[model samples]
Target: MEPKAHHVVIGFFTLVAVAAALVFALWLEKSQTDTEWAYYRINFDHPVGGLAEGNAVLYSGVNVGTVEDLTLAPENPAHVRVLVRVDQNIPIRANTKAGLVLANITGSMSVQFTGGSPDSPVLNGSRENPPVIEAQPSTLTSLLSNSETLLTKADQLLGSANELLSEDNLENIARILENTRAASESLLQSREDLIALLEQFNAAGARTEDAASRVSGAANHAREVLGKLEPVIAGLADSVNSLQPTLERLDRLTADNEKALDTGLQGVGELGPALRELRNTLRTLNSFTRRLEQDTRGTLLGEETMKEYRE
Candidate 1:
């Protein structure tokens, strides 16, 4: 029997449909790994605790990639290794740290990344040897550990408090209370004196306020006086500045004539001795004149007549 043409067409369509489905399946699988991505490893000392693959890898709270795989470290089986694939554009640096944090009260845990400084260089790695982001203690681990420590400390504190509050201590506490009550009674007895003292202090404070007001007024008056004198002071400064060139010229003239001035002063000093000698001669002549007046013949004469009169 000859094959029907419709059967051939149906068979060809079936093959085409199968091919299309396979291509779509492949595209979907490749979509997850086809992007330009960088790989990083996170080695945690604690167990994964339900943290599994396909979990979100968040960079500072924003989803940047997904956990690709989880396995134990080859070198140390005690450590859990998490392989993550992040967008290549997301800068991973040496300081970048990874930690497992619960998404919310009941949600699954996610890997969080921190420490991406703008100036820090990008961490370089490849699939063969990816850069490692050291895993910090999980939030749950830290909380539980800290709570245990706090409980221990609280127990110690309670024991110490119990020891400090023994029978004798209770009696001492009662005595302290009695002393406080007596002190309170004594304060009440002197209440009026205390009130008078407070009143005096208030009066002193008022006097201080008055003194401060006076000082403020004086300061304001001084500021006003200084403001009024500012223009006068500026004018004086300008006058001095304007006369500077004349002073400088006079200085230069003095420097130039210093030798001549010194010579004139020296001549004046030399004239002093001559003047003294002339005074001596004048005194001698006066004595002679006095003798001459006493005798007209002595006046007509000179030193010989003066000498005779002296004798």
Candidate 2:
């Protein structure tokens, strides 16, 4: 009897559980029916990121629908046909696009709906076609692949770098550093020569400055000399002017002296004959005087020696 009671209890509980499950299933169905829904289709030439049914359909990050079906397009085997059931009031327009999105790094993907033109009419049925967007390669996938390749290449490069930094290379580097040091020392030794050359240039510049100063001084001196000589030249001109009349008078005197000398010469020429006659008269007078002297001497008695001397 207890076993039968236990069986009965188990059967009652099983019936209640089945009834509850049916009620829950009916509630789910009614809830699904209550939602206003619409169907649309998109066609693609390739698998859209491995999109499957029940994938979320998002419009600007808002989940508005889900993918209902995926099949090969009837006309084109290469093309895939996707059916989407969205909320009825969502108002997908004719120009809307259905693109696949990678939702995660683990290759999970979703459908993104966008580009509904306001002027275009709203899509009604499955016949209303939304344009399928070609899926671009995901950045995450590309970055992951690139990271792997980069890490592999980095390892190879690191190995090569390690080989390059071997002991022989280190010694070569050391030798190069030593040579550089020697060259630097040689350059340092030449610094004094460079400084000396600069000093010489400075001295030359000073000398040039001195020469320029001397030239300026000479110019100033020349200007001063010319300034002093200007008045002297003016005085000389005045003196020359003052002496001009005297010079003219001297010239006139010289001319007059020349004329007087000429006139005197002419007078002397005119007196030549008169002077000759006078000279002859003087000679006769001298003879008369001599005779008178002789007479006187005779008269004075003792002039016979004077007469013989006269002959």
- The local distance difference test score of each candidate is 0.87, 0.80
Error of 2 at 67 (Å): 1.3
Task: Pull out the clashing pairs in model 1.
Answer: none
How many collisions per candidate? 0, 0
lDDT of model 1 at residue 2? Answer: 42
Q: Which residue pairs in model 2 clash with each other?
A: none
Query: lDDT tens digits, residues 3-121, model 1?
Result: 68888888999999999999999997797667788899888987666578998999999988899889998888889999998888899988778898887676578999987777877
Count of backbone collisions within predicted model 2 = 0
Clash number for candidate 1: 0
Residue-level lDDT for 171 in candidate 2: 97
Runs in model 2 deviating more than 4 A are 1-29, 73-78, 127-311
Cα lDDT of candidate 1 equals: 0.87
